[model samples]
Target: MKLRFGTGAILLLAGLMLSQPVLTQAQRQRPPEYREIMQAGRMEDPLAKIKAFEEIKQKYPNSVMMNSIDYLLVSAKIETKNSIDEVVKLQKDILAKSTGPGLITDYLTVNDQILRHKKADSFNKQKLVETIKKNAATGKKNANDAKILDSVPQQYRKRYLALSSTFDIQLATAYILAKNSVQAGRYLATFAKEGGTKDGEYFFRLGQVAELNGQKQKAFNNFFRAAGLEYKGADTKAKALYKKLHGNIKGFKEMLEKKLTELPFEPKHFTPKTKWQEKTALVELFTGSECPPCIGADLGFDGLMETFSNKYLIVLEYHLPIPRPDPMMNPATKRRADYYGAQSTPTTLFDGVNKLGGGGGKGNAESKYNEYAAEVERIIEKAPQVKLNVTAKLANDVVTATWSANKKLPNTEYHFVLVQKQEKYSGGNGLKLHKMVVRDFTTLDTPMKKTVLFNLSQSEKAAEKYLHDFEDQRGFKFDTIHNKIDRAHLKVVFFTQNKNTKEVLNAVICDVKK
Candidate 1:
C-alpha cells in the first residue's frame, strides 16, 4: 500500500507538469534582457536587438512574451536585410497565437512595413483597410471597456470620422493598387464630395484622385488650391507640380510636332535646351507584368521609346515582385522601392525628384512625361556640373563597371546601376515586350576622385569555385544561383551625388550594346 501510494503521487506530479502550459525561452530568460534589446533597437542598433530577440525566441518559443518578441524579430530581420516575406511569415505565425492588443498593434505596424517593402496590391490593400476598419469599429463598439478604449488615441475620434467619410478614398487608393483607374476615379469623386476639406492634405488627395481619373483640368485645379494653402511640404509640392503642368502643355505639343516631322533617332538630339530644364529626367517606373494597368503605361512607354528613340529620356523600370510571381525581381529593387516609400503599383518617379501615381491614361501620361522631358532638356542645356561616362564589361559570371565624372558636387550620394535589355516575351497578350530593367545597384560613399571602378571578377571566380566544389564534393547543386554571365544585352547607368544633402547631381545611361 505504501509503494502504491508513492507511485500514485509520482503520477500526479507528472500529470501536473504535463497540464501546466509550457514556458518559452523568453519566459524562462531574464526579462531585463528583452528590455535591454528593445532599448538597443530604439537606439538604432538593430543587429544587437536581433541577437537578443533571437536568443529569447530560441529559448522560449512558447512563452506569452514570444508574441511581442516575434514582432521585434520581424523588425530586426527587416533591419538586417532579410526578405519582407520572411518578416510577414513570422507576423502571421504570431497572429495565429491570438496575441493581445499591443502585439496586434505591432503586427499591424509590421504588416504596413512589409507592404511598403514589397508593394501591396489592390486586394492586399483592401484586406488591410477592411481589417483596420473592423478593428476600429470593434474598438468603438466596445467603448464601455475602458482598458480597450483607453489604448486608442484621443485623436482617433477625428481620424475615425475622417476615415468613415473617406472610406471610398482608401478604396480608390486600393483600386490604384489594382490598376483600375476607372474604379479609382469613381471612388475618388465620392471621397472628394464627402470628405474633401480645405486642408492641404485634402486638396492633395483630391488632386491625386483627379490625376488618376485622367481629369487633367480637375487635377490642376485641385493642385492649384493645395498650392495656395499655408502648409509647408504639401504647398511646396503643389507649387512645383503646378509650374511643371503649366509649362509642359506647350513644350510637349512642340516636341510632338517636331517628332512628326523628324522621327528623331535619339533623345539627346530631340531634347531642347531651355532655361527651365531641371536635371536628367530620371523616370523610375515601378511596375509588374502581372498588373493590368501597368500594361497600358508599359505600352505607352514603348511608344515613347520608339518616338524618342534614344533621346534624353533615362527610364528605368523597377519590376516590383508582388501579388504575383515575378522571377525577374531582384531583392535590391524591392529595397529601393521600400526606401522610396512606395505604397502601391504603377508608381513613377521623375528625376528621383518627383513621384507620380501611374493611374493616368495616354493623354495624361503624355502630358506628364513631356513635362518631365522638357524640364530635363532645359537642365541639360546648361553645361552639367558633372559629365558622367560609364563602361560595362562582363567576363564569365562577372560584371565590371567603371564610372568617370568631370566635376564633383557637394552633399550627394552616387549610385551605380546595371541594366539589361532582353527579347520580349509575353503571357497570352500576344504582344512582345522589350524592357530596360535594373539588374543591380551599388550606392557609393562620399565624393571620391571622379573615376570609380566596380570590379566583380574575384567575386565571380569565388562563386564559380564554390559551385564547382559543391558539385564535386556532394554531387548536389543549390536551387538558387545568380550567374551574370552570358547575358546578350547590358548597360551601365551612373549618378553623381551630394551626400550631405542626399541629392543626385546628375544621372546618365550608357548603352553597352553599341
Candidate 2:
C-alpha cells in the first residue's frame, strides 16, 4: 500500500473512471418527450401538436400520456369542425375512469351536439334516449351516487344543472316526435320554469305541443311568448308561424262578423248617369307571365273578362319587364309599372288606381277577382267622372291619337297605349295560340291644365326619341311607333285620367287581329 504505482496502471485507472457517466439531480427531473407536443400546442400549432401527440400515443400506448393525448385529439376535432362524434366516443372511453377537471365542459359540449343533429332514424337519438333513461333510473336509485355527481366538479355544478335542464328539453322534443303531447307539454313547462339559455326553444316547443293537443289559445300564447325571446333562428320561426296562424283566425272571425253585419243592410238601387259616354271603367293589370302567382290572377281575370265583355269594362294587361321570360312585356307596360310605384309582382289597378301592390295568391285569386268585378258592376250601373272621345290613325309606323274629354278633367296624369292582338301564333306544345300584348305608350303631359282637349303630336316625337335611345343602348329592335297601319294587326287604347284619383272616364279594347 505504501509503494508507488506504475505510470501505465495509473493512466488505465484514470481512463476507466472518465468512461463512467453521471447526471445531476436537475437533469434527472426533466419532463418526458410527450411534453414537447403540449409545448407545440401552447405555441399555437395545434394540428402539428396533435400529430406529435399521436406519435407519443403510438410509442407509449399504456403510459399516462395516452389519456391526455386522447382528450387533446377530441378537443381538436371539436374545435375544427364543431363535430362531436369522435368526442362522444372519447367520452365513452373515459366513462369508467374519473376524468379530471374540465370533463363536465366536454360532456355538456358533446350532449349539446347530439341534441342539435338528432334525427328520427339516427343511432345518436336512440343512444341518447337510452342514456337519459339509464341516468334517470340511476338518479332515482342512489340519491348520492358520487360516481355520477362527481362527473362534474363543484366549481361547475351550475353548468351541470343547466346541462341537465337541456337534457330535459331534449327529452321533451323526443316525446314531441313520438306524438306524445302530454309528456312533451309537462316537460316543456318544467323547462320554462327552469329558465335556461334555450328558453325560446322551450317555449316554442310548448306552443307546438299545445297545438298538437288542440289547445289553440294556449298555443298562441306560448308562440307569442317564444317570439318575444332572444333566440335567433328559433325566434324568427316562432314569430312567423304565430303571425300566420293569428291572421287566419282573425280573417275567419272578420268573415263571420261581416256576414252578420251585412244581414240587415239593403242593397242600393241602380241609377244611370245623365251622360252615358262619361261612364267607363278601366282595369289595368301590372302583371307578367313569368310570375307564377301572377299566372293564377291572370286566369281569374280571364274568367272575369269572358263574363263581362263590355266596352264599359276595359281590361288592359301590362306585361312588366322582370328578370324572366316575358314575351308579352312591352315598353308601354314598363312605363305603366314604373308610374304605379309597383316594385313587387302581380300589381293590379281598378279604374287607374293601384288595387294591390303584391297581388293575392291562387287561394285568394277568385275572391279578389270577384271583388274587382263587383266594383266594376257598381260603376257601370252608376255615374262616371268624365266622357272621352278619341280618334287614332297610323300613317307609317307612327300612331297618332287625339282625345277630348266631355267634362273638365282633374289635374291628373294620363297615358296613351298601343296594343296588339294575336290571332294565330306559335305556343305551348308547338301549337299556334293567340296573345294580347301592349306595343307602346305615350307619357302624360298636357299643354292646358285640367282641359278637355289633348293632342299626341308632341308626345309622339318624345316617344320616338326615347324608343330610338332605348333600342340603341340596349341592342334590341322594336316595332316602329311612327306608323303602324301596315302591320295589319293593331289596336289603340286611349287610357285617360289620373292614376292616384282612380279616374278612368273612357277606355276602348279593339280587336285588330289579322
Candidate 3:
C-alpha cells in the first residue's frame, strides 16, 4: 500500500513496514553545518536548490550528512524535469560512494528507480538492464554483509531483507523485458526460494515467463495464483487458459481457492472463549472501495469478525472515496476519517489509539490477519477504565440508541454509530461483500441524556448531498452512486473514548431491534 502520513509517523519500503529509528541524543544535536545544508535543500526554486546542494557537497567533502545532501540534490534535479538517464547516473554515483546503512538505502532506491525508468521509452534499455544486473550482484553481497546489516537499526533489518528479495524480482523483470526468459526464470526461482514477494505484478510476470518457456501447466497455475492475489487481467487470462486446458472451467474458482490455501501463509484462527475478563476491543478501519491494496485488509477484517465474537471484539469500517470515488462512502465516515487525520486506505486503529497502516494484495490476507490479530489480542489483555453498555430499537423509520457508561470521566466523548451488517457492491477492488460498514454516527462531549435518535431517511439524504459535493469538488461524476441503507441489516455500536488521547476505554455492539 502507498504510505501517507497525517498525524502519525510511519514508513513502508515497498510494503515492508519500517519504523523510524529513534535518534540518539548526540545525533539529535546536529552540527551547525548540517542545519545549513538542510536549509539549502528547502529553497523554493528547484534550480537554486540543486545548485546549493551541489555546492554544499563540495564545501563539506567528508561531512556525515553527505547522504542527505545527495538525496536532496537528486530530488531537486528531478523536480526540474531532468532526463531519466541523468537521474540514474547521479543516483548510481551516490550508490557507489555510500557505505553501511546509507549503502542499503541508496542501493534499494537506485534499483527501484531504475526498474521504474526501464519501463519508460526515454531510458537506454540495454545499458539500464546491464546496470541492474551489476547492481543486483553487488546489492546481494552487501545485503548479506554482516557490517551492512549491523549498521541498520534492529527494527529495519527485516525490511532490508524483504527489499533484497524484491530487488531480485526487479532484476528478473528487467531480464524478461530484454526477452531473456531463461535468465528471468533463474532470478524468479531465487525469489520463490526466498519466501516470494507480496506484489502480484511480479507473479503475473512470472506467469508470462512460464508461458514463454512453453510450461503450459506452470503458466496456468501461476496465472490463477496471480488472479487470486488480485492482479489485474490475471483473472480473465486464467479463466481463458482454464477453458483451453480442461475444455471447460467447471471448478476453476474452487480449485484456485484450494490452491491459495496451500500457500505458506494461513489466516490465524482463534479459539472462542466462554468467559470474559476485560473490556471488548474496538477496531476501526478506514478504507476505500476502489483501493486494490486494501483487499488484504478488507479480508483480514472479515477474518477477525468470524474468529471473535462482539462480546470480545467490535469492528467498525469507514469507507472513503480516496484515489477514486466509492459509493459506500458517507458523510459520517468522512468526518471520522478527518477526525483521525487518515490520509491512506487500510489504516486500522485498535481501541482508538494504536494505528497500523499498509496492506497488500488478496494473497496476503492471512498474513495481514495474523498481524492485526496479534495487536488486537494484546489490547484485549488490558483492563477497561470504564464499562459501557448499548441498546437500540427501530420504530417509525427511526432508530433510538441508548448507551450508558459506568462513569463519565472528564474530557471523554461517547460515540454512537449505525452500521450495516453487510453490503454487496462491485467496486474497483474485487471485494464483493463489505461487512460492518458505518452508515452514520453522532457524538456527545457530555450527554444530559443517554438516548440518541437517528432518522434513517435524514442520514441517507445527508449522504446523498455529501456524494454530490464530493463529485463537484473532484470535477467528475462517479460511475455509480448509492446512498440508501438496509435498515433490516443495521446494528448499533457505541464507544467511550478520551477526547485528548484518542483512546477507547470501552465499547459495545448489538443488533438494532425492530
Which candidate has the highest TM-score of all? 3
Writing each residue's lDDT as its tens digit, candidate 1 over 147-188 gives 543444453323223333333444554555555667767765
Order of candidate numbers by TM-score, starting with the best: 3, 1, 2
The lDDT-based order of candidates, best leading, equals 3, 1, 2
**What would the per-residue lDDT of candidate 2 be over residues 1-514, giving only the tens digit for each residue?**
0001121122222222222234356533533755664564453454665676677777767653444456555444433343334435554643343233223233333344344432333434455555544443333232234554454436434333444455456567667655678887777677556754333466667787987887766776665554443223434454455466666344543433343222111223324444444466777776655564464355456556655654666667766534343444545566677777775566677776537443322323344465566777766765666556656665544455656656556665566666655423232212122234555666557624332221234444544566566567778665433312125666666666665565665665543332
Q: State the lDDT at 166 in candidate 2.
A: 51
Best by lDDT: 3
The TM-score values for the models, in the order shown, are 0.40, 0.39, 0.69
Pairing residues by index, what is the TM-score of model 2?
0.39
Clashing pairs in 2: 396-483, 397-482, 397-483, 397-484, 398-481, 398-482, 398-483
Residue pairs that clash (backbone atoms under 3 angstroms), model 3: none
Query: What lDDT would candidate 1 get against the real structure?
Result: 0.51
The clash numbers for all candidates, in the given order, read: 18, 7, 0
Query: Across residues 1-514, which tens digit of lDDT does each residue of candidate 3 receive?
Result: 1111110011112111122255467755665577777588558887898888888888888765555666667756655543556767676565665656555455556665555442344566687678777777777777788887876767557656665676677677778767789988898888878865544666677788988887778888888877766567788788888988999999997877765444324545676343455588899999888997788888888888877778789999999877688988998998999999997898899988888776666756766787788887787777789888889999999999988887868888889999999988878876777889899999975667889888999999999999999889989797777788898899999988888999998889889999
Off by over 4 Å in 1: 1-279, 309-311, 360-385, 427-431, 449-486, 498-503
Q: Which is better, 1 or 2, measured by lDDT?
A: 1
